[model samples]
Target: MTRRSITFRLLRALLVLLALTVTALLTASFWQQRERVSTAELVERAKAHDVRIVRDSWGVPHIFGAKDSDVAFGIGYAHAEDDYATIQDVTLAIRGRLAMSKGSEAAPGDYVVSLLNIWPSVEQRYLRDLPEDVRAVMEAYADGVNLYGAEHPDQVAPSALPFTGQDVAAGFLFKMPFFYGLDKTLKQVFEGKAELVKTPTGSNGVAVAPVRSSDGATRLLVNSHQPYTGAVAWYEAVLESDEGWHVAGGFFPGSPFMLHGHNEHLGWANTVNAPDLVDVYQLTINPDNPDQYRLDGQWRDLEQSTAWLWVKLWGPLLLPVPQTVYRSEHGPVLRTEQGDFAIRYAGMDEIRGGLQVYRLNKARNLQEWQAAMALQAVPALNYIYADERGNIGYVYNGMFPDRQAGSDWRGTLPGDRSELIWTGYLPPERTPQLWNPPSGLVFNANATPFHASEPQDDLQPADFAPSMGMQTNMTNRAQRLQETYGADRSISRDEFRTYKYDLTYSERSALVATVQQMLALDAQDDAVLQAAQAQLQQWDQRSDRPNRIGALAVLAAMPVVRASEQQLPAVDLRESLLKAAANLQQHFGRLDPEWGEVNRIMRGKEDLAIDGSYDTLRSVWGEEQPDGRLKAVAGDTYILFVEWDKQGHLSSDSIHQFGSATLDPASPHYADQLPLFVEKKTKPVWFTEAQLAGHIEREYRPGEVTLGK
Candidate 1:
């Protein structure tokens, strides 16, 4: 062929070859996309078991199956059916993928996950540290969540499908730290107040034995105050397996095990305890390079990772965002405007938290429970334990760090001093705990663990080193419990419940103290203030539902009490009182209105008066509304009263602030528990097969329950 003809032919052949290559690439991509499992297939696999979920009147699920894994699988499906969005959100948050789904608003959380080194711990220890049975249960749970995601394509976030067993483990690793106040510690570092890494918010838990109970039996009040609705809010479930897995208690959306509650042989409760489990070290950054930090007078490279977050700016569309996270030998490196700091927290290297909780669920007696506690996988919280044997106990529990014996650990430690770094945790036996106190009573109101029981039987601070960063503060709840329960050797069932629901703060309460100080203010200041003083003087210290003066007093004191400022002026207390009075007068034309008139619990179309106040037994949290009313948000989410007879037979009751179906307001179960919750009443908890049989409104396995179009 001529040269020109050959060139044209060569060009045509080259074009043909490129077209074939493009076709092959397109085919491969299409096949890869098709190979990814669909939602329906995942759902089908999830329903592969003969598991059954029975719902009671309040919509609480009582799951049953032939095996523990099957029961967990059912629980996953059931929980997903009610609150799949939250479950997905929690898992994604733990995986540091929330920003990918939620956008920039979730970037901080993603940053936190990376900064905390959540996944590294899990990846390093999840398999070796987690028990096989517990891993199976977690896998089943992941299967349930994946199955639900498969079946509900419309509800699933884009790129969030096919969850695996690791995702389940990651959830626990991601969330367990927050429960113990790791989030607050991170906040301290971010805000450049690293020295303020104190114990988290307080909580109350009491387990009374037969000798302490009027009915000659055991009673437990599982009262945990958390954000009313979220990943941390109380969600109740009863899991049963022929392999001996039976537990009923409040669990977060993504947890495979009950965080706190009862099994057949024993029951337990958790109160937020403040043991200093986390410490911050100000790293000496290399002036020559920002990426290297000095430790032991030698420069060390910082481990760096990019955190990709998806920020949801509008609706379905999400923008991919990335942030840098660093880690040093001290732990997660946090670079703030002030300087580079590293956080060393208890449980940072542990990943058996879920396994420990699962073992606790399967624990048959005090010994078994203690064995689980010995795992020390959980970094914080005080546990109140009681069993059918009438035994009662309390553990001011945490994986406490073994800091330098004489170092002042409460303040920021020097990053360059390698000796200051805690290398290991104090063994569980060495941790502060009390078992069967002579008084036959065990209680913890987020107070110092050294004072968890009767003064005679309480753990002494001298027993623990000051370097452990143990909390020394006592909340009003602890003070009241001591006055009420500690004063009485025997407590009646009604009285026990009454004390748990107490709305009146003691005369020496923090709120009362603030009010008293406010009343001591000079009245000659201003006209608006003098009228406010008149209202403050008439105030009674009761936070009861209809107390009028409570509104003004509480409103005024809220600012000073909840302030994050490093130093608050004493005069600000008086100012808050005056402002509170003005707020009440401006809104209601009078300083005194029933507390119920000022504080309400509203959801959808339902509005009702709520009882309780900050630190009261009835614990109600309210936020100011646009109309000047305080609306309840957290506090008093789910309340449980567990009772066991002399023969070890169990009967319990519970109530939730909201109904079981968190998603569908149209469902009858949506608000069924609210009235009972507000009335301080509880619906019977169906634990046994016979009990569940009688109360079950409907029973079905996964895929059996229809989602109507």
Candidate 2:
């Protein structure tokens, strides 16, 4: 062969070899995503669990079994039936493998999973610390999900199968810290930002004793505001087992226990509580060795590991990217452009959060419930309780760190001091809590725990150490609750429900202050601004659907409110007013459009007016849209009202922003509750068999789902 031909042939051969290597890598990645377990095996596992799933007319699952584990199995299968995709996503997120499916957008979450040492910690404590029964329930729930995945493989990710009990517990471990805004702190560190801002989102929990009720009935409002969809959204279900684990309430996608709702004798509501549960320490790195940080005047080696993130690049291709994870004596270490900082958060190395919830689910009374609370496994939340015995209580629940009293807990501390690193939590009895108050009412709206009840019954901030870092801010909902429920001496059932759906802002509300600021602006040449000011002056401070000026006032204040909540620079009143007025006129041809026209709750083929505004008791937080309407995104999602009469007979009602079939648009129950939810109405919760007798739409065992029921 000629020399030129020989060189060309060699080059061609090299190109072919490169193509073959690429194909082999792609094939290997694709194979990794394939399902390995057989459907028949999953079916056999399902058959082993003796559980019954009964779907009510509204498509809510009432799970029944001989044991709690069996009921948990039913819960898993039923929830998966409604939102299997979300469960798969939750699993992926907990596993720190979200980037494998969602691409680069989820890599940060994957990195956090490694940085926190979620898997290793879970593996260490899953069996050693969790009770045998709890582990069984978790494993059974996983088996139930596995069964569903195996049978309906098309509904889930190919690789999202064979879930285990460890995954369930890890989900709790991964998500608990973020409840108190740990993610925001991490984001600030990642972006090299200074300081952390505690902003109010939404949640309202209230408990009324018989003395406070007009008809001598104990009442509880289990209202938690979460995004209308995704991992944190509430899924409603009623679980019953022969082993005395009967309860009805909300469950997250992967959870087998009720996060909040009523058991046979009592019930509680959960609201997100912000406490100084997380501490960030600035590390002093050694000049000679980058891997060593100064602590206690000596160099300590930082623990290091590689986080191998399987990120999806495109179709059937995963890029393995390795990043270094570091840990100091304080806790997880984050190396940023600013410096290396260590985070020691509550619930760190704790895997008993799910166990705590499980114990709470089975607790029969206040004493048993308090024992569960003593676990201190759940990092943070405010729990408002009511029971069948006309008792009510409020617990501003958190695993508050026992830190040195002098240091600023809200700010970053020096890493060199070992004493600043808190190693234990205060006992639950010392937690800011109230029981059967003289005022007969307890409530929280993501507000100051010190003001949860009537002034006489409220906890004094002075009694607690300043190192606890309790929130001092009060929301409009909290102020309104004081004006409505707190002011009323004898609140009737109608009034209790009315107070929950209250659409009026308190006179002292920030919205009113913002409106006053807008009215004070110099609208010298701007006619729209002048008109908006005139509208605001005549406003009733109510976000009712029929109110015309309410739309203008809310829209004008939203920019400032959003900026304040996000810790961004303050928005100018003149600018906000002029922009809001102009946008309203453009969309509706008038500045005085009805609040209904602006605030909306829309679902598949259904668009309806929703009454409520930011921080109101009705609590509708909306997103601005191109059509000039505000679409309800969060606030007032899963609301439950439980009441026990003088005879101790329990009756409850609930409403969901969306219905039971959370993900399937084709399901009739998808948006069935939206209209009622918007109208401030509710459906009866069929807690007992007698109540559910005529409400059954379908019934079946796991792995034996009958079609066209």
Candidate 3:
């Protein structure tokens, strides 16, 4: 052939190859985006669900339905309307498909889903273990989400269609472990060694019986500290059904059940409680075979599977990355450069979490609630309960593994010994719990269960097994509760509300101790240091917005508190103080700006000064900014106050950091409640139809034009 003709043929072949590759990608994308169910079919499914969603003036959904499943459907649709993006993300994360849209940064979470065998367990037991009623609710919820996606195709991403009941079930399975810091353990293992950091994040739950109340009313504080926005952030809702599934409380993005709030007769609050529920086992790898491990004098092959993560390279293109997932007899195994470690965490292969939450939501009184608690499906959380009957209780809830008592459960154990693996959890009765204490008060501030109530009414350390690994740490919020609420003989309604929004740090708080230490520091001839110390000394240990000296003291103490929380070595407080002073002077031209001027809560164009600091009872944890301001990010996202008067009449008030439009900035409800939240005020919950009659902004059924408002 002629040289020119040969070159032309080679160029033509290359062009043809490129076209073929492009066609293949487009074809794959089309298949991934294909309609799982038509919008018409989804609407038909909605018709089967007799549910009505009523949006109150604050845009909180009050769902009325014929059955519990119908209520669940309404919850899914209403929550999706406000925060579908987060719900979609939760679904993707549970399905091990997050990397398909979020790119490489989310690959680890996707891989963890496979490595943990989350889907396999869900697929297996979602049908068998979960009862028909629970399964119906989950499936109906998924249907509602699917219906919304079908109607709003523009907002739907590829592979985001056809959310299933199993997805909802697996969400609890995957996300629950992270509540106790399993994700931190995985990160440490992946880095090289398992040097886990235990940072007990904030939340406060307090319940007071009528006996302790001056007005003869039972009170419950459902204050859960979470990020201002994300998968785990709180969304407020009120659900009612003919099947007795009435509840008014907070829910996570993808959850159908009210995580914490009040039902008609009783209500409870959840705070993150970390006991050592996760165990790491160092496996002995066989020399002859890399995939085999030594277990109980036998060479056992590690069950292996490949997790194919479809990472988004760009638009219409996905790169399939194959990662080998390993599992040992202990549980999910992670082979790292340090060693192959197997993790057996609480609620592993336990898929009945939704069932337990459903039962708890339907519980009419304390006895029924305790019966639901006995399920033990929920792995971790501190539950503070109060009801109409003047009963109050606290449970340091955990599915603590019944491990051999002699072993150091906190450290890595031998994977070779099958006997070391725990097959069951302790019964609910063995859990550290206090019911109707003589003090008429029960509370948890991410503190030890032993000191949950008055010293006399508290659970003793001797009562709980050391093998249970219950946390013994205390928090400043807990200290303040003891000083204020515990010290009070008869708390009035106003006092109860005032104490919840308490901005004063306890005299025993770490912030006070740190301030005292800072005041004692030798200025060392530095005028700036002397001035900063003087300002800190003026701190009244209050994080109120009007406090001028609090800006300097809390700013300086943040580094120490943060370091301690993250299990890092103590930061140099002197250096922190100096740096804080310099930043304050540089940004505000003074070292003592008002606390409000330094701390803010901003949403959209609205920026407002907020109260509360690092460990205060008000609890506003903020993120530092370049402008020397602390932007409130977490700690006190959702707050609920529930009360039952002597006549057994129920009432509630709640506040969210932002409004009902969780991801929609354009909506009027987006920041409508921000002012109230920043000002430490709450709107009435309007739990009953009679209360909601004059308050509703709009009402409609699912698959209607009322969405995306």
Residue pairs with colliding backbones in model 2 are none
Which runs of model 1 end up more than 4 angstroms from their true locations? 1-41, 193-202, 313-318, 564-571, 705-709
Of models 1 and 3, which has the larger lDDT?
3
TM-score of each: 0.91, 0.95, 0.95
Tens-place lDDT digits, model 1, residues 1-709: 8999999999999997676556545544443354364655675667556688898867899899999889988888899989999888887787877765566777888778777777777788778888788888888988888877767777876556666677778877777777777887788778854343222254668888898887788988888887767778778899989999999988888877888889988989898866788888999989899999998889999998887665554544444456888989888887889888899888776778888888899998888899989988888888998888999999888888887787768778889988888789887778888999878888888777876778888888887878677887667788888878788887998888888887776786667777777777777857777777677788777788878788888888656654522133333876677777777878888888899988898776789998888777788888888778988888777778888887888888888888888877888877777887888888888888887766768887776653321
Superposed model 3: Cα runs more than 4 Å off: 1-33, 36-40, 193-200, 705-709
Kindly report which residue pairs in candidate 3 clash with one another.
none
Residue 523 of model 2, lDDT score: 81
Considering lDDT, where higher is better, how would the candidates rank from best to worst? 2, 3, 1
Give me candidate 3's TM-score against the actual structure: 0.95
Summarize candidate 3's per-residue lDDT along 306-417 as a digit string, tens digits: 9998787767677777899999889889888888999998999988998899899999988899999999999999999999999999999999999987999898898899
